[model samples]
Target: MTSTPTTRNPPTSTASSLLSVEGLRVAFPGRRGAPAARAVDGVDLDIGRGEIVALVGESGCGKTTLARCLLGLVPPTAGRVTFDGAPLPRSARALKAYRRRAQLVLQDPSGSLNPRHTVYDVVAEGLRIHGHAGDERTAVAEALSRAGLRPPERFFLRYPHELSGGQRQRVVIAGALVLEPELLVADEPVASLDASVRGEILALLLRLRTELGLSALVVTHDLGLAWNIADRVAVMYLGRIVETGAVEQVLTAPRHPYTQALLSVLPEAPGAPVVLSGEPPDPSHVTAGCRFHVRCQILAGGEAERAGVADACRHRELEILRGGDAAQVACHWARAEQPAAGTGDAAVGRRPN
Candidate 1:
């Protein structure tokens, strides 16, 4: 990899984008003498108003860190994140107001909901924090109703231990909705729910978008969920986005080796499931060239070698894959005007560790 800080080009916010991340990076100081861990490195993403964007990646791929940075919960080491044409503020008062407009719905309803708090109290906490002066009861009830808890008053006094998994999730959603935020950042929103409950929560998310014009950035490892709900999908690996495009285009016919390997493992996927050899390299010690090169099926198949780009695959640094309707892949061979030698829909298998 090479360094050219002056040449770093971040994505500029588009008019339709409600939230934008421009060349963002977050590096954490390493333990002991280890190198600093690059949790989120050079990620560019855009979420349009009223649109749903899925940030899909394996565990430890830094999707959660990226989401945290977007919500201003963590500071970035480089670049910037903007919301509604304005950069995220640093002042406590301004950040508090920013949080009011951009809420987070966590993955586990049980972990998120306070066990002792009544549904009404849980949802009203945000309003109280923001010093909302409007009718508190009306606001809480409206949020509950919107989150699909009909006859909101019935559940108002019920505690978290009294609600079903789906109901608890609804309560969590209502807490975020109580303030009527413009955007929601949901990290692994349905990971803990049963299959039946997962669909319902996903439906609730879709319904919210349709009815309230709420934009969202959903972080998950499930590609199937991305196809079902997101307008677009961004595939992240080891602190970087390797592929991104409209969900249909990227999921149905992927180009990047990493993206192809991921989609091929879906139960309904057409080809043999690709079992990657091992976990991704440690973020603190990222290898050069493509972040995914070591695990890339295409590279293992000798396609990069045949295409005369293997050295680049091992030594060159790749730029961030920008988000758009048309599919984009960050790869030395795949990005060449000509496709890599003997390229196919997918090239996958076990590689030597």
Candidate 2:
């Protein structure tokens, strides 16, 4: 079958978006009359061409699900995902073509690479799958070089077990690069590597972006990683983005309590780590009103009550952070704090609550 393009353009994104998602939701069915588990609920995100956006959150906060949705590996239950100003293709052929333009780098390299396949075969697999008409050896070599594997020919006969952890990851990246994707959705790209190797992998990603003009959506729980590479950071809680802004602004001066609690634990954090009580935040069983209300330190620590916004905090569901350059926090308490600091509602991108 021949590949085709979809002309559908969603109303949710700006023209600058290389990849965007609007109100995206993905849910899994529950047994015995139970409500489905919504892994990704009401998310809005964008990654511009040549820009790196980090999606930061703890485990089960839907970071991976959202990444999967963006790559079309998992379909959203509601809302839409767009690439290059076009909606995700519905046809198989179109999807295949879209995938060639956008690729994924998984968290674990050992599991992602097959032990039986040589490095040459692994990197050349995508070219073979896509039926590349160009010279295979040259394409493979260039990809390997781009991924930082020096003298790419030396690794051609190496198996997965023959390489170091970082080398295996570079091979995985080379595999994706064989297709010359425009975007990469890297899920915890450095988590599995040694501390020393982590920086190397990150540097490789940054270099790729600069040299190839590639866009990336880096999904990780490490704010430190986001600080190092991402131009922007979106801090997620439960299943929604609670705060977003330029990486420096959001990481240095996070407004959402959820974000604050997350950053407090950093070794260099000015304040001590916030010890959160009660159950962990989960998207599978989201409730009405503010999903973070029950666990919110602002409410529990009596800050919201003192600000006279406790009632609103408990009942109002905040909208997604508006896109663009503004540093926004989707919390009533943040708005309340803004007034005291003379920043006002407009400063926080406060929406109707």
Candidate 3:
């Protein structure tokens, strides 16, 4: 296999980043006395106010774990998360306030909603939780309307079982929005819906962001979804962020090896598919060099060059793993070559063996 790089225009930044995560790491105790498993090694992110950023990675890459850590649902082993220049709370009260400020719309809408409660009660739940009982009815109406459940009165008394898949998902969104949060953490929110409903939910989320001034941290493994909705994209590998850049830049002109391989499998056109030769390696092993070096297509000259590239690769990888950072790469030869725009030859060192 050969590595290739393409150059594409970056997204226009309309405003400043609202949420910033620096050197975030999360670890869980291993079985017995063994070392802890580092779920999120070192991740840095920046989500501009009113902008949507997607965390793209396969299962076990720590996208969900990172989300849980950011929300304070699971305490981080290290690093910090900040919102609008204010540090997140570590205590329950502060955490509750943080949760109010940043709500989550889970993937499974059917499972998330209470079957016994009507859509009205479900949307109004957050209002009551936050002590907004005085105007609960009006708030529910507005939220429901915003989520595209028009004629809110009609859907008000309808139970979860009575609503369609799309309707149920909208209610879940309305439930989260009733709190008037600044950030929305959506974990694969459209993954469980039908193809048609997926587009509807995505459009709703985008519309909500525009109408309500809400920023988002979307977590999904689908590159197509990220390409469609996210302003910027972050690719994770083995519990650490491998690459992050403007969605256009990373999607069309990915700088990291893993990012290239990911785009490879995704359809470049209607019938194209870039298939992988083997499954990803286990994340538990904790390799010494670049976490992706094992599967990377960028080859070094000899054992010494390979080892040197691996070490240099590790250093450069972490430096440019977040948006707004310089676009530096890890591989020795590839980095030195700095592939010309729109050419695979510049990145592949001669050709694949």
What does candidate 2's lDDT look like per residue over 187-257, in tens digits?
99989999989878988998898889898889999988888888888988787888887777677777789
**Quick one: best TM-score, which candidate?**
2
Q: Write the per-residue lDDT of candidate 3 for residues 200-285, one digit (tens) a residue.
A: 88878888878888888899998888887877787888887766656776777776767776777764633344344456656556
- Give all candidate RMSDs, comma-separated: 8.1, 6.9, 6.3
Worst 10 residues of 3 by lDDT: 1-10
Query: Could you estimate the TM-score for every candidate?
Result: 0.91, 0.92, 0.85
Poorly placed runs, candidate 3 (over 4 Å): 1-15, 269-274, 300-334, 339-353
Give the CA lDDT, 0 to 100, for residue 70 in model 3. 83
- List model 1 lDDT by residue over 114-152, tens digit each: 898999999999999999999999999999999999999
Candidate achieving higher lDDT, 1 or 2: 1
| Higher-lDDT candidate of 2 and 3 | 2
Off by over 4 Å in 2: 1-13, 339-353
The best candidate in terms of lDDT: 1
| Every candidate's lDDT | 0.83, 0.82, 0.74
